[model samples]
Target: MDGLNDYRRARVAEILADFTTLQFYIAAAPVDPPNQEDYYTEGWRALRQCAVDGQHILNTGADTHVPITKGGLEEQSKAELQQVHLDALGRRHQGQKIYLRQAAAQRWIELRNGILQGKKPAAEHQASLQACDEQLWLELAQITDEGIYADLQAADIQMGRWTGEDPSLRAVQRWIRSRR
Candidate 1:
């Protein structure tokens, strides 16, 4: 049973080595603007490979076929490099260039930090909702049943309502009513 576990561990180490090689290749590849998404996707894949590779490297002994090299220095370096790659991928995967939620969260954090540090400007220390101008506030602000009916009438282009007038709002409303 121990031998079986050892054998499995050795296989895992071998697989990890392959994965690390793949990651190195991905990291070394050049990126094109239009294919940036593809490049990032590949980067993520590479990071995943590195994680698997590092795990197997740890699982198997340094004396195994997977060479740790001169007190495991090379393997250690590779593992560290892979970890950096993984972190980079994780940060990148968190959002796209114009993600709304990420931008909002970042903005909120920045605002909070600035306020906490007393760096925020006196005029803009906190986010505020702009009040409606009193001059612009009219009876339209509080819509009436008549207004809703008028809007429904205007929306109906066809004379489908009870009114027979071709261009009247009621006619349009009637037309719409028939369709529904």
Candidate 2:
């Protein structure tokens, strides 16, 4: 069980790193030896991919401004691993098919909630987050100005903000800055 859990965790990480929303959806389950189908054909695939991305960002190696019990690599019990798997799968099965664009919009909500609740850290993470925010903002802005809508579209979809449709230059800029 431990080995399987580790493998699955690694798989999830790779999926998150490899996809951006524009790529085809790689089905994680409910199918035999599931495989990825390009979004050009599978609409649902895009949504599932978006949810995966959202979960990854929110659960990055730390709390999303809220203290959730640590799990996965840091966890020791099978129950913890199971909970992580179930949580990820449940989100995929529940909720409307999330799109990358919608996911990005949701990031703002996460940030606001985290801040409103007074989720603060010792000055260390603050500087790191600020730098990350600035870098991502600049990159997104540059991409937007270059008229790289496809990239933004992929990012939006991966982030699960599908309802927002195509990402606007302003939205991408706002989302990037609002992070951390």
Candidate 3:
């Protein structure tokens, strides 16, 4: 049991390190072309892999001779591991927001420059700008959803009950107040 616990801890540490690397990659990703899909794709892949690995550890520990108290501790650790993933998702979502905003701003600038240079902005440019706006809204919706999910998970951890309320309402209100 002790050996299994040690192995689980080591595996958790490795997953956390991988998550940290993924966060850094997400943060440093470029907003412009020659766009790199590999970075985003690989980061997501690594995150999902970490999740699978954590689940595997939990399942394996359950099958082992882990003591009752130790098993409870492992369960708590698993919850905390889930929180880490939620936090990573939040960070990645923010990074995507930044990238989308930058891309939109760049497109608008290009459109303005073209007008100033006596060239009508291409229809494709207009379409691209609109697409960026739509994408931003979609990303924002996803971020909000992730935040709500994280809040629910947090409530479950802290209160041990799943209350199906809109956890992000207060956060949204606070943001609105700050903007005002």
Candidate 4:
């Protein structure tokens, strides 16, 4: 019984550590733009490469390959992303950018500090960070894609949701950065 209890505790601690690291990678301003060394970003890189090369190993162990496209996937991806962003912004309420909840902003500051100091975030911090992420997605959802597009000027094209110097608010409106 003692051994099993110890194992459970250890497993919980390990999970918390991993979660903290992920939250740091996502919310930490220090690693803004997400370096390749950050967790899970490599998957996107691999997918993008596969899209361009027209190949994917369905089973890595078996080395089974599948082709997606012969070429120009990159360009197509850009265009689609641009269109998505334009569509989203076209529905914004007076071009409103990312808004952070006060509680989340407080947690964001604390989490960034913990990440910098290499400390695991407290459970409450994790919840707050998660809430912040959820709020952002919810706000994005409100930006209807079917909104008027003709009203958009070239200057209205915002780009990139890079993490920032500001803790209270993020510049998520400038998402996609297609630079049409």
Per-candidate local distance difference test: 0.33, 0.38, 0.40, 0.32
What RMSD does model 1 have?
28.4
The TM-score values for the models, in the order shown, are: 0.20, 0.22, 0.32, 0.24
Number of the predicted model whose TM-score against the real structure is largest: 3
Q: Residues 1-180, candidate 4, lDDT per residue (tens digit)?
A: 112333333433433343344333333222222334333332233223323222111111221223343346654443443333333332231222111122233344444445445444467556654664455445445444223222222223242222121111122233222211
Model 2 TM-score (2 dp): 0.22
lDDT tens per residue, model 2, 1-180: 335555556534433344333223323222211223222212233334555755654453421232345564444444454444333322322221233333332343344335435444446556644554454344334433334445534554677642222224455444334432
Give the count of colliding residue pairs in each prediction.
4, 20, 0, 3
Error of 4 at 21 (Å): 34
lDDT of 3 by residue, 4-76 (tens): 4443444345434543554454445433322233224322333334344333332331112222344566665
Candidate 3 has its poorest 10 consecutive residues by lDDT at 58-67
Q: How are the candidates ranked when ordered by lDDT, highest leading?
A: 3, 2, 1, 4
TM-score of 3: 0.32
Model 4 residue-pair collision total: 3
Q: What is residue 112's positional error in candidate 1, in angstroms?
A: 47
Candidate 4 segments exceeding 4 Å error: 1-119, 148-180
Q: Which is the winner by lDDT between candidate 2 and candidate 3?
A: 3
